[model samples]
Target: MAKLELIRNFCIIAHIDHGKSTLADRLLELTGTVAKRDLQEQLLDGMDLERERGITIKSHPVRMEYAAGDGNTYELNLIDTPGHVDFAYEVSRSLGACEGALLLIDATQGVQAQTVANVNLAFKQNLKVIPVINKIDLPAANLELCYEQMEEVLALPREEALCVSGKTGEGVKELLEAVVSRIPHPELLDIPGTAALIFDSNYDTYRGVVNYVRVKNGTFRRGTRIRLFNNGIESEVKEVGFFSPEMRAADELTAGSVGYLLPNLKSPSDTKMGDTITDVKDPCPEPLPGFKEVRPMVFSGIYPIDTADYEQLKASMGKLQLNDAAFLYQAETSAALGFGFRCGFLGLLHMEIIQERLRREYNCDIIATYPSVIYNVYMKSGEMIPVDNPVFLPDPSGIERIEEPIINCHIMIPSEYIGDVMNLVMSKRGICTNTVSVDARHVIITAEIPMHEILIDFHDKLKSMTRGYGSMDYEPAGYRADKLVKLDILVNGEPVDAFSSIVHTDMAYGRGRQLAERLKDVIPPQMFQIAIQAAVGGKVIARESIRAMRKDVLAKCYGGDITRKRKLLEKQKEGKKRMKQIGQVNIPQEAFVAVLKATETNS
Candidate 1:
């Protein structure tokens, strides 16, 4: 086994588009872990979508060999994590595997919202946070302003922080040295039983489920019998390997090391991130501390456009779930859209990513309804229901008082656009908790708002208001009392369960009118007129109509007696009854998706 003192475990944390992946590529090149000829942009980002979007969706861990100035060669395991708020849980899981973290801030952007949020998490975990400012090669880079932001906002030592450029090989050598000298090696225990933290896991057709773990005590070797501490599921370790940037078979992963293990796991549900893995014969006495389960914060209904694709969609979702254990979904049916799945996601971005993958990866055509947040419904019948799907909203009479999930949102923007940003947030039921200046031109605002409001294009609007100079981060802050009402949509007098949503009473009328108008545009004209209405319970709040196809039936008649007029009127009434009974409104697939865009009140 390698000497524990020669090992350094850490992860790189930064905001989205802050060059974290580029820095990882540079580090790999400098360390010679991967040949220089093989290096490419975002080498660690394995997902095709990640590369296309220029973002890291999943956390990638790699082991590197570095020769420090002290003339001693050290081994470093660096976990590259996604920087978006939607993947914060991935960040947390990655941090739990390491003893230190590289807290990177963009020199041009300084310390934005997520920058401070990452530092606070490092502080919470007691990780050795090595502060660094990147993109110093850019002409607009404000190195001095970055120092001040780190000092004032992050409360970091400005003089000690390193400045580096991922674009050009500058200051990276010193940063590597700092990591080895400053970051402590993992203090692993030598006990009779084995223990490891499964920070992340994914599935393979041949290998079943492959888990990436950090061994805290003992060793994990091929042929060793392992069990998950929480679930008590047991399997024989088929393989033990470390990332040589690619999975290379390692004889064993000793204590204080991170690697992957194939243990003949049957299914993804059999394993979980943050669960303790131990030897089956000699299980540990206790699991690790502070293992919070992944809870989905945003939910939406994903219905297949064609009813026959329901089974294929279900199989696709199951395969996707084997890779992502955090994504929750259940089979559901809608009268308007037919068979579908009600999926729960960590955030709006997470929801969108899942929806995109369903269409792109599985080739399944789907209609995703408006995203919703979980709600707690208390009823007079002494039943409390958790409503994640909009179709299952409890009746208004039974609800004692509706409670909505709230969140504490942090927004950082340029001082010049502070008024615009504040106005935008306040209009979305935001209560400003605090506002402070980060630097001469930057300001940070803290607000408490309904989480549901944020799911509906809040980030998009925030960027539009701040001219793309703003960044945001937020977390769920318990539930609170709210005046929420369920708004239902009816097409041709037939209620569409897919379009129902529980919205704030004050904004329901506006949202209803918008939905009606949008649907009127999308629902094609039929032989007979189709009336679309949005109602709150039994009262109609808004209405729109798709006019019937007109024909010149009266062109043939120049004049008529009362008998002829009466006969024509009777014939028109009979046709109206038949149309009402049999006519079907050809609702465009775009109509369901249009409702989500219509509900955005961020402006």
Candidate 2:
């Protein structure tokens, strides 16, 4: 093991498709941590879905050995982070584990919304930032332009920016040397107690939960009592190791080293991200800076397509929750869809990933309800409660106010498309606060918009309007009072709680009308005309009717007497009345998720 003074810990940060993973693969190869043949593209992205989507959904940490020009071998730990703003929290955790960051920019695309946001975050963390322009081998690569944007937008050095090709390995050797020289070694803390930051973890069915940590103060070894300072949970260490892209047993990890610790954690929740790890005998006087608690901003109900799959879905979710503490769910019953779990997520991507994992990993078929954001309701009795699912929302009379979440959204796009993009955002109730021109071609637009407004198709719209040249990053701007109402869908006068949603008062009429019409298209006609009504507090805003199956009662009575025709008509009326009374509308599973399907199509 390298001495503390020779250790360098850092991470790669960039915007989506900015070549973060490819650059990481290059770094791994430079260090010879993994042989050339062993590397597949984006090797750090472990999940198949990640490869399929061409994105990094998780942060991966690895340790490497590099021999710098200074004539000393250094222990280099690289924590690779996700690029999308939806995974911003994950990026923060990864950043917290490092002392420096490699800010990679696309030589062609230049700085973007996430690029600016992540660089600012790194600055906030006080990590040494190294700007490296990537993809210089591309035909459209413009190194000087990227440098100008980096300097203007990120306040980074123009000349100090290094140009490299992550694909062709151009200038990579110099980049590694630069990392060793420029990125300072981790500060050696000689405090009496031991301390480590638990930035990430993964669960294994066989060996249990393994926590990835950056040793901040003292040594950690196997067969010793250890404690998680946040929850004061302690257990004897079962194993201690390091990841050179793969687990390798280590005798001990001291201050300034990155490694993994296993305490036989059977449940992943036990090893919470951002928790502090310390030696049980001489614990730290205080825990390291506690990470911000991430709450699920978007929520929806998930039901099994097959009723028998409920237990399977529940089991899958339980195991998934063990692996992902951010995913939250509780038992919920819908009058229209039967029993299911109401789940909460950080955003749309997180929600989509979890749903896809359930389908692909667990082989479960499920229907998800319309996603909604949490709302704060003040009741008539001076009580305040958070309602994530519409079913829990109290009557309008009983509630004094409803507060909805809002966000400060940052958008980066080419200057030519700003008009259309701005108009689209403004239509979603966005209020622009600031705009800046990094150069003549690119601009950054900052706007405040409702969090839920961007829940469905905001990104897709931005990309479409900008001709796929726009990107967005956002942070919560807190909540404010809004004119909100719960729009309920009723089929033949019977309300379907599963189709209920909270919407802005101004959009209630049009959205309700759209939903009712769409429902009409999907619903099969009953023996009697089916009335689909969209209502708010018992007041109907829009309505649609599905024509019933009609029969020519007199067709078979061509030669029959008028008395016979009258008798048949009476019998038909009785049958219609009986069907309308005893027969329930059989809503197809597709009908339950029609809004989701529509949103997907739009996206």
Candidate 3:
């Protein structure tokens, strides 16, 4: 077992593209986690999805041996966390496993919205914050400006801040020394019991659920009888191990170290991200303190494009959810769409990942409805029900009162885009709460808006307003009563429940027009014209038509070309078979994406 005094726990925090991942790679290289010659780019980020997207989707816990100026080798546990707002919950879970955070500020950009949010979160978690200003190699790098921002925003002293460029290794040694001297060593709890907190986990095609945990209070060995507090699951520790990018069996993992436990717990729900793993022989308190069951924030319906793939889609969801506890699934039956899943997710990215993986990994194509927010309704008799889909929503008469969740959003943009952003925000029913100049050229804008309004395209609008120079972060605030209406999409006068959403009146017209135009792009031309209507209640707000294809085939083919033409026709027929027949119209994958992405282009 590793000694407590030899362990150091810290997380790397920064805004997007602030060189957080690059710095992590340098640290691993400096500590010999990867040899100088064999090193690949961004070695700390193991996921291809993460590397392609240029963002860390999950926290990576890596152990390294670094030699200090005092000529002593110390073991360092560095955790790299996602810097995006969509993965805020995951970031929080990762922060819980560490004792300190390395707050990196881009010397050119100074501090950003995510920077403030992460610092506040680290403070709330009681983790020590070590401020490091990165990218001093850039010509525009303003070290003095960054230091002032850190001192004013994060309350870090000028003397404590370290300057480093992970790109060129400039002043990086001083930064490493700061990490060793400034960050507190983990004071591993030495209680006479086995208790660990699961921070995150992933599903391996072969190994099942690979749970990442931090030993909070004790030690555990293989074959230990452990009980998970999240879901009353009891299982023998089939495997007790630590991650070296891959799982390696360890006889026992002591307090202060991060490791994985394969409880052989079939379901990811059993080993939740925040659940406590305690010794079944001598269990801790009734339940863990920080264990709040994760609830999905956005809900949508997913149906296979080919109805034949329905069973495959369900099986895929089950396997995927085993590692992604944030995904919620329930069998749903729609009058117009047949049977599908009422899937829920933390946010848009989470929803998109599941959908993308379903097609990419499972080899099954599926169609999804517009992402919708959950609503709480109180009836005349004072009964409350959580309505996830607008199709299941009770009539307005049945609803004595209805309220939707609200979010407190922060958008940091260049000063040049203030007017355009303000107009956009106001149109989305966002009430500007506060606006402050973060620096002479940039402003931080805060707003309180309905979660539904900004869920679709708020980020895109902020980006467009500032010419892709702005950043945003938001969190759920609470629920509020508003003038909300169920907007439904109708094809051939038949309402498609999957395409229905509850939206505010202020945004209905703009969103409706966008949806109509997108539907025109997505819906394939059929034998007859297809009418796409965006309606509120019984009234139509916007409409578009997809004209039937006039010349979709080769009229005359010579010789061997006839065979090719016949094959093309066969392919078209196969494609049409996968589409849903709405009266005379055929709806394909492109149509579904069109409706889903209509609101994606807000500006």
Candidate 4:
């Protein structure tokens, strides 16, 4: 076993595209964890979606052996974490397993909203933070501005900041040495039995569930019997190993070490992330303070395109839930969509990633409904009901008031684009709470907005208004009473539950008009006219109609009397009117997908 004093556990935290994965690749190369010939960009980003989008989704952990300038070899456990605001929960869980973090900043874009948010999370965990300015090799790199922002916005010391180029591998070796010298070693609590914290877990088709953990005390061996502290379920350890950027077998994992363990469990749901694993016979007196339960902010319904794939979709979601702790789901049936699941996610990006993964990794073709946020509905009797789906909302007469989720949003952008961003925010029903000048050219704006308003296109609009120079981060700020109403879409006088949404009273008319128009373009014309109407409390707000396909009834009346032609047309009209009364509109899968895309861009 390695000595405790020679071990350093740290993770890299930064904003999106700020080079967290790139810096991790350089560290792996310098430590010789992976050979130089085998090195690649974004080695830690294992998902195709992540690589294609140029972002990190999951937190990756690996162990390295670094020979430092002090003449002692050190064992470094590095957890590369995602930088997006949607994945902040992943960053928080990763910080729990490490003693320190590398706070990376881009030299060109010094202080971002997520950069400040990550620093706060690290401080909450009491982890030591080492500030590193990345992308120093860029032509627009401004080191002085970076230092100023670090001091003014982040309250971090300027002298402690280290300048490094993650792309060119400049000063990486020195950064590693600093990691060994500056970052404190992990402190092992004096516990009686083995207690390791499971930070992450994934399912392997051949081996069941594989858990990635950080050993807090004692040793975990191949044949040791273990129990989960949260549920007290016992199992035998099948194997123990470390990630040398890939799984490498080890005889045992000792104190203060980060590694993976295979337990004799068959289902992915059996093991939970942040659960404490300890020896079955001699467990610790108290369970470790695991992570707080993550609350999903956005809710949507996911249905299989082919109804026969329902079971497969369920299994796929189970595996995905094991991988993503922030995702939540339950079985829900819709009159328009049939058997499906209502899934909750952290944000729109997180929701999109999950849908893509279901298609690519699990080969499950799915359709997602328009995203919505949970609302608190208080009735006249003082009964409060939480509603995530509009179909479950009570009658208008019984509802005393509706409270929507609010979020405190922080946006950082160039000073010149402040007017455009402010206008965009005000249009989305947000109130600018404060504005602070970070530097002469940059500004930070804080606002309070309804979570549902931002669930669709707020981030995209912010980026466009600021010319891709703006970044945002947000957190839930509880719920407030509002004039909210549920808008239902009726096709051929039948309300389709899948197209219903809870919207603000002021926006109900415009939003309903947009959705009704979009639906008209996608829903195919039937033999009878289909009236697409958006209604709130049985009052229609917007309406559109698809003209019925016409049949040439005058083809057999050539050279006949005008009365003969008119009688034929009248008979055809009667048939059409009767068909319109009895015919059912079959809304295709493409209509749902088209409306979803339109809402994401225009909402």
Q: Rate the local accuracy (lDDT) of all candidates.
A: 0.87, 0.88, 0.79, 0.91
TM-score of each predicted structure versus truth: 0.96, 0.97, 0.87, 0.94
RMSD of each: 2.0, 1.7, 7.8, 2.2
Worst 10 residues of 4 by lDDT: 286-295
TM-score top scorer: 2
**Which candidate would rank higher by lDDT, 1 or 3?**
1
Models sorted by TM-score, best on top: 2, 1, 4, 3
Best by lDDT: 4
lDDT of predicted model 3? 0.79
Q: Write the per-residue lDDT of candidate 3 for residues 1-603, one digit (tens) a residue.
A: 657776777889988778889998888777776778877777777767778778776787877778889877877778789888878877888888888899999998888889999999999999988888888899999887787777776787978788888888788778778877877777745455667888888777776677788888777888889888766778887787775544679898888888888777655555677878899887777554576777889988888766677788899988878767788898888765567899999887777778877887788777787778989988888999989888877877777878999999888888899889888888778899999887677788999988877767777767876888888889999999887878888886778776777877876887677777877877777755678899987889999987755447555555685679988788766665454363444466556655655544432
**Model 4 per-residue lDDT tens digits across residues 402-492:** 9999999999999999999999889888999999999898999999999988888899889988889999999889999989999999999
Any runs in candidate 4 off by more than 4 Å, and if so which?
A: 190-193, 551-572
Error of 2 at 20 (Å): 0.9
State the lDDT at 342 in candidate 4. Answer: 96
Off by over 4 Å in 1: 190-192, 559-570, 581-590, 593-603
What ordering of candidates by lDDT runs from best to worst?
Answer: 4, 2, 1, 3
Candidate 2 lDDT over 1-603, as tens digits, reads 778779999999999989998988998998999998898999899999988998898888899898889899999999989898878888888888888999999988888899999999899899999999999999998887887897788888787788899998999999999888899988856566999998988888898988989989878888879988767788888888898898988999888899899886686777778989899887888878857677888998899988888999999999998778889999998888888999999898999999999999999999888889989998889999999888789878889899999999999999999888889888898899899897989989999999888988899888988888799999999998989999999998899898788898998898889889888889988889889999999899999999889898888888757899999999998898888888788898877777657845652
Residue 518 miss distance in model 3 (angstroms): 5.6
For all candidates, the clash counts are 0, 0, 0, 0
Cα error of candidate 1 at position 57, Å:
1.0
